[model samples]
Target: MAHYERDLTGNVDDLVAHLDRAIPQGSISAKYEAGSDHRVGDARMLVRAYERYSALGGNRVSLCISVLAVGEEMSLSMVSAGGSEAVFFKVNTFGEEAFLERAIQALESYPG
Candidate 1:
């Protein structure tokens, strides 16, 4: 598995929409599996799950993105998993890491 986290300032809705567009555009096999947005008092949260074909692993891998915002501050977390093919211990993590690179590129390219 691979993980990434960041804290920044932006409109939650806009950030979510940006990621919604950016993540899936990285590769032809990338896709948005599901997503959710929720609000509580002055805070908001968004979670999105995506899948992409991992050529190295010969399988599909998952990427999960979670965002939380309150006022003008936002926190983002992303995790990539499911590419390992070991029967027990983990192996072949390159596919997972490559999948995560998509999210990193999208976040770095965010206009905010």
Candidate 2:
């Protein structure tokens, strides 16, 4: 099984390393708009990346972490041979945090 992991820590090197490790030989044609290097500025960018990647015939998974003055949030999603799934959790960031946590958990626990 291939493993892909990404953290929204704004760490470009870490993101690149994870992509390199996760993608199989010749599986990934390229890396488009990784969250590292500030290439991913918003949720729209992320969604677009995933859509494009999926079109390329590869599994795509993403974990996004967002920090705000009020609190923090985490989001997770998967797109692959099994299909596509996404969830959001919202917790300390008011109600948004709970959504983020739940989304991540659901996507992670999904049988697919």
Alpha-carbon RMSD to native, per candidate: 0.8, 13.1
Candidate 1 error regions (>4 Å)? none
Backbone clashes, candidate 1: 0
What is the RMSD of candidate 1?
0.8
The digit string of per-residue lDDT tens for model 2 on 1-112 reads 1122333334333333343333322224323334432233432223313111334223343333322211122232332221233234311222222223333443344332
Compute the lDDT for candidate 1. 0.91
14-72 per-residue lDDT for model 1 (tens digits): 88898889999998999999999899999989999999999989988999999999988
TM-score (C-alpha) between model 2 and the true structure: 0.22
What C-alpha lDDT, on a 0 to 100 scale, does residue 29 get in candidate 2?
A: 33
Give all TM-scores, in the order shown.
0.96, 0.22
The local lDDT score (0 to 100) that residue 78 gets in candidate 2 is 31
